[model samples]
Target: MKKQKIEISLEVFETISELPKDIQELMNKAQQARENAYAPYSRFRVGTALQLASGEIVLGSNQENAAYPSGLCAERVAVFSAGANFPNQTITSLAITVRSENHEISEAIAPCGACRQSLAEYEQKQKSPIAIYFMGETGEIIKVASVMDLLPLGFDAKYL
Candidate 1:
């Protein structure tokens, strides 16, 4: 067997202010969306803001249910909404952030595996990269160029 390594590169920002003005605004919108999350059970709120090719920004917040499995993540909410409302538009970027009811996050927040796969599909559909900006607990940011980088070996239509 041959040894192989998979490495990914991401950009780190000391603060939201360090990013471009548009990204900073996107982060602000995500934070606002976080305030509206319906996460009574987990009390862990998350927000996502997507920027589309048409220059429209779409926002989403986590919605939880007592059944647990009925809950939807902020990333998917934003992506699905964009797909449903703006099918012709390509998503160019996304800003995500999370907050805990009881504690603070010390590092950047990442999307769950499911969200990564969902985002990978969108990346494939658009045939381009979708920049991901993850906000850390302390207001720092981590930027990924593509969801495909986050979910290696992701399934696509070609596989079916």
Candidate 2:
């Protein structure tokens, strides 16, 4: 058997101001959404913002449920909403931010495996790379060129 290595590329910015103006604005929106997250169980609030090709921005916050599996992540929520509302528009970029107990965590939080897969689906549908940006509670912002970077060899409708 042969073992293979995969490398992911990303950029770290010391501050949100260092990002492009549109990306900076999306990050700000994500931070605001984090404050409104309903996560009494995890107390880990997450917010996601999606920028559409039309320049429209959509925001989503983690919604927790006592049933656990029934609740959805901020990333999926934003993407699904975008799909439902703007089926023809492509998602240009996505920015995610997180906080816990009213304080931003100082480490970048990547999307969970399931969320990554879900994002990969949209990326495939759009036929365009979706820039992804995240931040730790503190420190610099992290930028990934596309969702495929997070979910390499991702499964999608193409296989079926």
Candidate 3:
């Protein structure tokens, strides 16, 4: 048997100000979108903001429902909107952030598996990488060069 190794690099920032101007703005937009989340159940509000090659920024917040799993994640919401609204445009970057009501969160959190899969589809469609940035309510932020970095072995249409 043979073994293989896979590694991904991430950049950590001490504060929002440490990021580039455009990224900082994207993060800020995520924060604003976060405030609109309807997290009555989990109290785990999440927000996502993505920028297109056309310089348009789309924002989304976690939406909850009475049913167990009818809700959608912020990343998927933003990505779907971008796809529907601008089918021909390529998404360039994405920023995600979360705020919890029960406790203080200080570490960066990545997107869930489902969200990752959905994101991978867009990356595949555009034939380009979408830079991802994520963080908690406070503290450091994390940046990944692409969604594949977060999901190295993600499933795509090619698998079918």
Best by lDDT: 3
Clashes of each: 0, 7, 0
The number of the candidate with the highest TM-score is 3
Candidate 2 lDDT (Cα, whole model)? Answer: 0.92
lDDT of each: 0.93, 0.92, 0.96
Clash total of candidate 1: 0
Two-way TM-score contest, 2 vs 3, winner: 3
Q: Which runs of model 3 end up more than 4 angstroms from their true locations? A: none
Error of 1 at 135 (Å): 1.6
CA deviation > 4 Å runs, candidate 2: 102-104
lDDT of 1 by residue, 10-88 (tens): 9999988999999999999998999899999999999999999889999999999999999999999999999999998
Assess candidate 1 and give its TM-score to the true structure: 0.97
Give the candidate order by descending lDDT: 3, 1, 2
1 or 2, greater by TM-score: 1
Measured over all alpha carbons after superposition, the RMSD of each candidate to the real structure, in angstroms, is 0.8, 1.2, 0.7
Of 1 and 2, which scores higher on lDDT?
Answer: 1
TM-score of 3: 0.98
Which should have the higher TM-score, number 1 or number 3?
3
In candidate 2, which residue pairs clash? 104-137, 105-137, 106-137, 106-138, 107-136, 107-137, 108-136
